[model samples]
Target: PFFLYLPHTAVHLPLVPGKNFKGSSKGGAYGDWVQEIDWSMGELFKAIKAEGIDEHTLVLFTSDNGSAREKQGSNLPLRGRKGRTDEGGMRVPCIVRWPGRVPAGSSSRALTCTMDLLPTVAAISGGKVSKTPLIDGKNIWPILSGKSKDHPREAFFYYQMDQLQAIRSGDWKLFVAMDSKKRNWGNPEGKKALALYNLAKDIHEDNNLAAENPGIVKQLLAHAENAREDLGDVGRPGKGQRKAGWVKKASPRLLSR
Candidate 1:
């Protein structure tokens, strides 16, 4: 009946744990912050049970991106880090909890992204998404509820700023030709131009199969082209992109006096 978006500033830069949680973790400041978040979740569940809405609530826990390489976090087994287009930069944990609705201890490997949250939440709440301006999200409740095995998303495109970086369709992920800077991490040469990986088999993205599988590369390229037409890429503006509202001489104001 209600929606609560609780975003925590912890586990980010300037890690500051509560006085009670300070020095509680052996991993130092980062671990202390993690423990603090764990405590926060416990408090939230306790409140939910007290309100008797625990059974009706559908909770989703996820992160915007993988751990920052500069931080004490690790994205082991996956190549590259937060700023790159590698699996490490794009992949993050997504946990859904709904009592009696979503089966406990059940998991799905269905590829999903942050964009899918809009439609999925809308579907779960019995809300309708507007037709105009378009939406790139898909309802994934069926996938989450274990009612469907099919992938709701056909493909997911990756972008670093306005540049289309990669495309993932099914198990295949293709990185098209593009120049990169040194900060992209793994790709020290600063040019990946063309690369392909079967994520199911090569989660580390070490083996490049782009030469062996030309057909797949071509298919993913076509998908990328289509995305560029709709969502845009470097040097090109997408037709589907909505013009952002701007204010002339905008001024900041305090939320409270």
Candidate 2:
């Protein structure tokens, strides 16, 4: 009730629905799964109202990352799928409902990320941070209050621990793939490369504008330099922030190579 994270683990793997909600939707397996998640959320919402704290409570609903829409998961109009720099993977679903606090059925496309949550909650609770650094976020109070409609930070970096690096500046997003001589970003294509998408125009990311727009690439790279520093070489081992279990003792050919 105090801190509720209603994440859908079933959405990630196996795609299995429990017996209680096995075939409950007109949309098939995925639809049924979505309905399950929705039903659970309804419970949370009802509980808050039952406690008569709906007005004071702030409910933030969002996915961790974009859906791997390419995995037959359904990206639809959004280009690309999960696990890539496509909008589907990064452009998550989010909604904030606060009775009397937030305007009803409103939307804000101010470009946000997960890291911004801590500082916001801290500010909301009047928290004190003596030693712990703010780390990749700040208190986005203005946005929540409907006073501001843009990100407070000058720049935001999305790091996939070396597989790729994405930096957001204003409306432009730059994605640079990390190639490890050990395993490279696009080696499945063997010399394949990272592609850039002007999410504004090519939300589906169908066109590879990297070669056609060298000037844009240059500009994006310059902006991306800041994010790349913290990004490790994906093809190279031991560089990722948190090593995956499979990467621990894997051979170069199996790990990065």
Candidate 3:
């Protein structure tokens, strides 16, 4: 009968932990912050158990974006950090717990994003998803309910501001736009260059297989073009882009009182 959305700000910038947890982690302030978040999650789970509806409740936890590189945090083995269109900047951690429905101690490598939440929640709550307009989410209930192992999402497009930076199709991620921060971020040569990586094999994204795999590059580029045409990215204007639902403000008319 209730839905709770709890957004935590613990692991972000200004990594300051409580006095009790100051010296708890080997990762310094960031480590301490991470531990504190774990503690908070434990408390949340305890409260769910206390409510007596733990069995019926479904909980999902995930980050909005990848870890921040501006702060001294580690999105280790992930090529780029926050603000760039790389796995480290977009690929984040997600955990879902639905007792009796979702299998326990199970994990899937399905490609999913935050956008999928809207449709997934609608499917779970028996809501009309067709009424929702201008949505990119797909219901992942099958993947969650143990009915299917494959996800319906074909590709995920990465955008920083209005720019379409990258797209990941299957296990390969291709970069159409360059990372502007590549110079200071450590790879000057890769700045604004076309890059590609097989994420399954190169988790760190050290290898740029774009030159070697022209066919795969072309395929992913097609996917990107389709997304651009639908979403209207920086250089390309989309014909299929949905109109924004902005309400016009009406001017007040002067009346004799």
Top candidate on TM-score is 1
lDDT of 1 by residue, 1-257 (tens): 88999899988888888899889988788888989888999899999999999999988899887778646578888887788788998898898999999989998888888888998899888898887758878889898999987778888998887888899999999988877634444544466569899999999998999999999999999999999999998789998888889998989988986
Please, what is the TM-score per model?
0.93, 0.77, 0.85
Q: Scored by CA lDDT, what does every candidate get? A: 0.86, 0.67, 0.81
- The predicted structure with the larger TM-score, 1 or 3, is 1
Clashing pairs in 3: none
- Give model 3 RMSD, 1 decimal: 5.7
Candidate 3 structure lDDT:
0.81
Model 3 compared with the native: what TM-score? 0.85
Error of 2 at 148 (Å): 0.7
lDDT tens per residue, model 3, 73-104 = 76888867776667887788888998999998
Instruction: Give residue 115's error in model 1 in angstroms.
Output: 1.3
Per-structure clash totals for the candidates = 1, 7, 0
Can you write out model 2's per-residue Cα lDDT over 160-238, one digit (the tens) per residue? 5354456666666666664432222444433446676676787776776788878877877776654444544344433
